[model samples]
Target: MTTVVKHATIYTGTEKIEDGYLRFDQQIQAVGPMADYHPLVSDDQVFDLAGQTIVPGFIDVHSHGGYGFDAMDGNADEIDQMVQKMTANEGVTSYFATTMTQSHENIAHAMVGIKKAATKNPVIQGIHLEGPFVSPLFKGAQPEKYIEGPDLKAFEHWNELAGGMIKLVTYAPENANCAAFERYCLAHGIVLSVGHSNATRAQMKQSLATHVTHLYNAQRELKHREPGVTGHALLEDNIYTEIIADSFHVYADMIKLAYQLKGADKMELVTDSMRAKGMPEGVSELGGQKVIVQDQQARLENGHLAGSVLQFPNAFRNIIKFTGCSIADAVKMASGNQAREFNLTQKGTLEVGKDADLNVLDSELNLVQTFSFGRSFNPENN
Candidate 1:
């Protein structure tokens, strides 16, 4: 029955501790220096946190809904109210219910209501889909009569009605069923990525799919001698790329040139937010068109853009003020490189054992208290 938490400064995606101390109940049993934590008994629940900073709980493997709610809103209670409004207002201890481009019976009815609201919401950690097999000349807001081309038997009949929970997919690796959709996402391990593309970096390195969907907006730009697929998403060093630092989708100097060309363990920070995220701009709606969030972007009144009203403490403080980096490399691109490219080994990093997915920030990163797997949250009493 631990819980501890002491004076914190933490950031353990790699290192940074400062008067730390951690502990936890559902997992992470220990963490460092608060003079090496004591209080092992006497109703252990502690919590000092007088300096507040912690990290870890942020992972958004490409979102598609938020407060006004729309994971296609096929409704499994509006995808569990967009997973309790993204873990009580975007501290999001996990995400990825994406789904856009509609109609294949509304993307298999929003992946059978996002696989039954991800089995009753453990922060809905699966489905991404983002297409009717993408790329109608960089289909940014994805809807050109619901585009479609790639098919692997209609993605294994909507991955057998979402029972497979569809991990990820954003086609256009040269879709014409690009080699049977890369042999059905490498024989069902899923996660293909590449984005509404105009592929050609040799058909995006011939569909081996190293991942890259929101790197340079809808994809395909880095041209010099025709270095396309956004130049293998910025000179591929095994591309992972997906940064949407939100200041109107990737600016702050191209999010500091994609974190200096994919660094924080190959960059992951995503918030392709929609449902006009936490609402309140003007009008909203995503794949069914009609969006217009004004000042924070999210366009599509024939203007395009359309997917971002970003949260996750403002994309983790705009990736630590647009890549001056640190805060443990912006929590390793907002949650340890998407939990190591979705293997999700007990979700991202904190140290000791794992799972007590974290949060709690102050040195301007904002979100002051959230935790997920061990269940305590408080975006001002959400």
Candidate 2:
């Protein structure tokens, strides 16, 4: 059966069209002006969205966990709970189960759990390993005990454990043997994102030249002399960049600057949220390390910044408020741009021949409804 949603204010991640209609049968079949659609001739279930905005369901390329469940917990049930929470509450139709820096064994175990979760739920895309290969100098909330230098053997082991389901990996470009690892990741269809490093501008250029395609710019700061990886990320046009957009991780002006420099097409917004997200502020565990949340920032006992408490929808709202970007552009950052960057051909945008994943938001920007693979899910269930 076909589902036809009409009379919607459609934000197709690029343009806004009032009184638009979209038709889908497991996948998008057509999209155009609502007046052109005839529900009488078509054997379809018609839903009138009134004037609510319909956009592509969020695609979170980088996230740790949410709703009191951490991805690194290595529990399939916990991971499933986390997925349900994100999908129901935030309208995240697809997401990467990002793992924090942990032991080789722990990372492998977490990957296995993620693989199991993804097998059961199509919305849980794959695993994003944020480290074991990062620099200790920039290891914000990651435990130093788990941080390790780049090793091909470890990478191979992780790959095998994940059943080749690893989609993205973050590491320090300046780490030993990183060039070879970055090349290997590219060869295996894995996205290598530079992050948590103090690499100089020259090192960053060299790293990007070698095959690294993405960079994480949430935690790192910009300095005049150092220029840092964040500077290099802004300067590089070909590479995609991820920003947290939580206002605390980056200033409003810097978010605007990144969008201008990288263009909205090349930028992806990530939550990087921790377990404490959507919960009351208090102590929490991230990758086996104790973290304290106060003043809207989460930091380890040792004072290293841990993951964030920001959810995906909140991040989207902040990006729009801070950057003055159009809602279409902001939605693209959350879904379309992310899908394009990760080469996820099926899961982003509301065009024909794409996945039937979408989110409906009211004029207030709150998620009103969500559909994943043509099935509607309720946020109140979370």
Candidate 3:
């Protein structure tokens, strides 16, 4: 049966429809002003939203794990549970199971487990390989001992183990033999993202990478004279930068500054959250290093900023607050940008014939409910 949602403000990623209606079942069938809406049958599932707001489902391309489970644990059942929590609590209908820099064996194991979980859970869209080829100079929470230079052969092995599920990779451009690595990734439909690097401006300018991971954190900082990785990301219009807008990872003013530079089209809002998220503040571990979670921040023993505990819904709300951008623009940052960058054709915008992945929000932009592949769930009760 078709589902109809009416009397809502809809952000279709490409446009906004005030007092509109949406029709869908696994895929969106129609979207338009309320005057244009016509129910297909008497028994269709119709939801009178009472003037709520609807936007495309949020897509997180750089999340590790959450709800007390780490993706690196290599447990398919636990990963499934973690993804369920992600959908229920954060309105993330699609996610990338980001992996950490670890031993080859451990990384391989994680790839296998993520592949297994993804087989049963379509929400596990792809894998973001974030390690083993990054620079030690900016290894924030990544384990340094396992950091290696770019190696295409090793990456090919891991991707094979993942059944070709790896879609994005975070690496330092300054690493040796990076050109070949970047070439291989580009040829095979993988996006190369610069992160955890200390690359100088000249080095970064030579790179073909089109994405930036957790911008301004664990990477070369912007210097008036040097204009390193951070500056490069801001200057290049083709590069999509991921920002953790949790206020702790990036100050609100700085987020606004980035928004001014990159605009909504080139910036993506990612949680980058870890296992400690959704758990009470206490001692935890990330990438085999002891971590302390307090004050809404997660940090390593040496006081380095670990992955965030920020929820996706909070990040969605924070981006609008920090940038003062319109909800339509924020929707682009939260979902539209990632879909365009990663080529997730079925997952992003709310329009005719697209996947029925979307979220219902109150006036204040709080996620009230999520509909993933035509299945609805209330976030509050989850």
For candidate 1, the 10 contiguous residues with the lowest summed lDDT are 36-45
Model 1, CA-based lDDT? 0.81
**Measured by TM-score, how close is model 1 to the native structure?**
0.37
lDDT of 2 by residue, 1-382 (tens): 7888889999876577788998887788888887788675664588889968898999887788878898888788888888877888899999888988877778888888888888778888877888878778877776788888888888888888888888888887877777778788888888878777777887787774321222344324568887777777777777778888877777788788888888777788888888888777889888777889887778888776677888777888988898888888888788997787777888778888988898888898888888888878778743
lDDT of 3 by residue, 202-319 (tens): 9988999999999999999999899999999999999999999999999999999999999999999999999899999999989888989999999998999999999998998999
Candidate 1 regions with alpha-carbon error over 4 angstroms? 3-15, 18-20, 25-32, 40-93, 98-102, 106-108, 125-129, 136-194, 199-221, 225-240, 243-266, 269-331, 334-355, 358-372, 375-382
For candidate 1, the per-residue lDDT at 107 reads: 84
* TM-scores for every candidate against the unseen true structure: 0.37, 0.93, 0.98
For each candidate in the order shown, give its overall lDDT on alpha carbons: 0.81, 0.80, 0.91
Using TM-score as the yardstick, the better of models 2 and 3 is 3
- Model 2: lDDT of residue 50: 92
Clashing pairs in 3: none
Runs in model 3 deviating more than 4 A are: 380-382
Q: Candidate 2, which ten residues in sequence have the lowest lDDT sum?
A: 210-219
Which candidate would rank higher by TM-score, 1 or 2?
Answer: 2
